[model samples]
Target chain A: GAGVSQSPSNKVTEKGKDVELRCDPISGHTALYWYRQSLGQGLEFLIYFQGNSAPDKSGLPSDRFSAERTGGSVSTLTIQRTQQEDSAVYLCASSLFPRGPNEQFFGPGTRLTVL
Target chain B: QQPVQSPQAVILREGEDAVINCSSSKALYSVHWYRQKHGEAPVFLMILLKGGEQMRHEKISASFNEKKQQSSLYLTASQLSYSGTYFCGTEGFSGAGSYQLTFGKGTKLSVIP
Candidate 1:
């Protein structure tokens, strides 16, 4: 892909359901990141991956929130027992540098609505 | 901590100019700017490093003052295509600590023709 791409531009789910969001980063990029933004709120860092190393999962909000990156390319974020408060836009970004303090390219984002 | 952005929102006629401010309590080493249209992901604009550096892209411009941990975004002679939400993302340092940004809530701008 030319840029970072995420699946399902929008997802609407019941409060008790689980949802999975996928991200396929641009080829050759070594760093990936996930973030969530509630309505009118600043972005919240969720996770980060650098190549094949153990992902930096420090930002995951709760036990119900988890993510994994396989093959150093595609990643998935899963949220279980979705709460209304979980409704937000989930964004994925990728960068070319391993030690990326560099610019990141973003995906269109997946807007999740928990009803 | 989240960066502080002023005015929350703004409206302007095409060709007008506007400024958005972002402030942080912690010392900043770098700042980035992004713009997002409704229902879309943010697009990277420009970055200013710890030292004074002004960066511009087309009609959009930004400045960062590391000492004060503040940044300003300028939309000069705005166009209808410029209508969007602008965000200021602040970072504390370049190494060890994550370079990930702490973003402002955003400033919504409407460029009316």
Candidate 2:
């Protein structure tokens, strides 16, 4: 089976520009999540989508960050007016369900660099 | 809140045992463990629920202490393949129905033959 996949493994953008990162979750996965890994830092939760319920955006650092999952499979994270601080690896993951001991399968991630 | 991982890094020799710990300031419902090699996605190791249930995966095992809000990953007879960064994700109640995980700064483990 294909694991979670991310597009444009690397991206470079200028400050104040907008960038979008895409993720394709595993088949039949009902839950999807987004996270960011900064240099020498841990993964920070960004957003979550479970089935058709409202997505959780609590982890989004600022208003410039947002995400949407369509058809319960593909998710896109958009950062408006990118800042140098946004330079990090954006990761996507998926699982069978919303809660429980389910392990989230991660993607290779997109390394974004803002100059 | 993000959990705290002890010993940011560790080095071990084959056949030796090692322990990695994750502690949270707030009560936790479950803890998830993962291992990732350079330039690869994180691979799931195991998950320990709040009931004090201990789970094992091959040579790896984990224990969750609900009272202390801590989890420990135990690796027996470490192998060179075990070299990677280990991350612990924690889930807690936030008054909302949804559950999201907060990950800790990973612990890098290097095992040599």
Candidate 3:
């Protein structure tokens, strides 16, 4: 893909149901990021991955959230046992490693609805 | 850590100027600016590195002061297309491959012509 792509642009599920979001970064991007934006809120950082570097999971709000980037290319964010408060737009972004300084290219994002 | 954003929201007429501020509690390595319109993803504006230097991207510009851990985005002669939420992503530390982006609450800007 020419840019970062996400699957299932929108998802609706009942509380307690699990959801998996996928992200395919740009072909050569080595750093991927996952963020969540609630209604009328700013982008919340969830996790980040960089080639050869241990993934940073500090930004994740809770243990129910987990993510993994395979071969520094593709990544997935899994939210377990969703709750009504979990509804938000999940955004994925990629960049060529923020070496000295660089910008992140973001995807359109997936809107998750928890009933 | 979350930075505090001021002027929660702003409404401006085309060609007017606006300022959005992001203040962090922790020391900042750099501050990044991004614009996100309704229903769309964020678009990078520019990043202000340490040393109080300013970074400019087109008509949008930003400045960061490592000492105060604060950043501000300046929009001069705004256009209707400039209406959107502006965010500041701050990096606390920088060294051997340490990069993490912490965004502020955001300021919603509505430009009315």
Candidate 4:
């Protein structure tokens, strides 16, 4: 079975530019999450989508960050007016369900560099 | 809050054993473990629920101490393939029906033959 996958394995953008990172979750997985890992840092939660419920955007660092999951499968994270601080590996993960002790499967991630 | 992992890094011999710990100040509902090799996605290892259940995968095992909000991952007879950064992601109650994982900085384990 295909695992969670992210597109554009690498991306480089200038400050003030806007960039979008895409994620395709595993088939039939009802929950999806987005996280950011700064160099040598832990995974920072960004956003979460479960089924059709309202997305959880609490982890988003700033207003410039946002995400949307369409058809309960593909998710896109958009960072507006990219900042150097946003340079990090954006990771996407999916699981069968949101509650319980399900393990999230991660994608290869898209490494974004903001100059 | 993010869980805190101890001994940010560790080096072990191929036949040695090692333990990695993750602790949180807040009450935890579950602890998830993952291993990531260089330039790769993190791979799930195991999950320990709040009931203090222990889990084992291959030569790796984990224990959760729900009372203390801590979990430990044990790798026995470490193999060279065990080398990677181990991350512990914690899930706790935030608010009305919300669940998200907060991961630690990670413990880099190096296994040499």
Which candidate has the highest DockQ of all?
Answer: 2
lDDT of 4 by residue, B1-113 (tens): 88999989999999999999999998888999999999999999998887756899999999999889999999999999999999998888777466667899999999998
Question: DockQ of each candidate's interface versus the true one?
Answer: 0.57, 0.76, 0.59, 0.74
Model 1 over residues B9-34: C-alpha lDDT tens digits?
A: 99999999999999999878788888
Indicate the residue-level lDDT of A115 in model 1.
98
Candidate 2 per-residue lDDT over residues A1-115, each given as its tens digit: 9999998899999999999999999999999888999866988988888864545778899999988888878989999999999999999999998755688999999999999
Question: Per-candidate interface C-alpha RMSD?
Answer: 2.1, 1.3, 2.3, 1.5
Please write out the lDDT profile of model 3 over residues A44-109, one tens digit for every residue: 988778863545777788899888878878888999999999899999998886533589999999
lDDT of 3 by residue, B1-113 (tens): 78888989999999999999999998877788889999898998888888757888878888787777888888999999999999888877633347667888789999998
Q: What is the TM-score of each candidate's chain B when compared with the real chain B?
A: 0.92, 0.96, 0.91, 0.96
lDDT, candidate 1, at B10: 99
How high is each candidate's TM-score? 0.94, 0.96, 0.93, 0.96
Ranking by DockQ: 2, 4, 3, 1
TM-score of chain B of 3: 0.91
Chain A TM-scores for all candidates read: 0.94, 0.96, 0.93, 0.95
Each model's C-alpha lDDT?
Answer: 0.86, 0.90, 0.85, 0.91
CA shift of A88, model 4, Å: 0.3
**DockQ score for model 3, please?**
0.59
Q: What is the lDDT of candidate 2?
A: 0.90
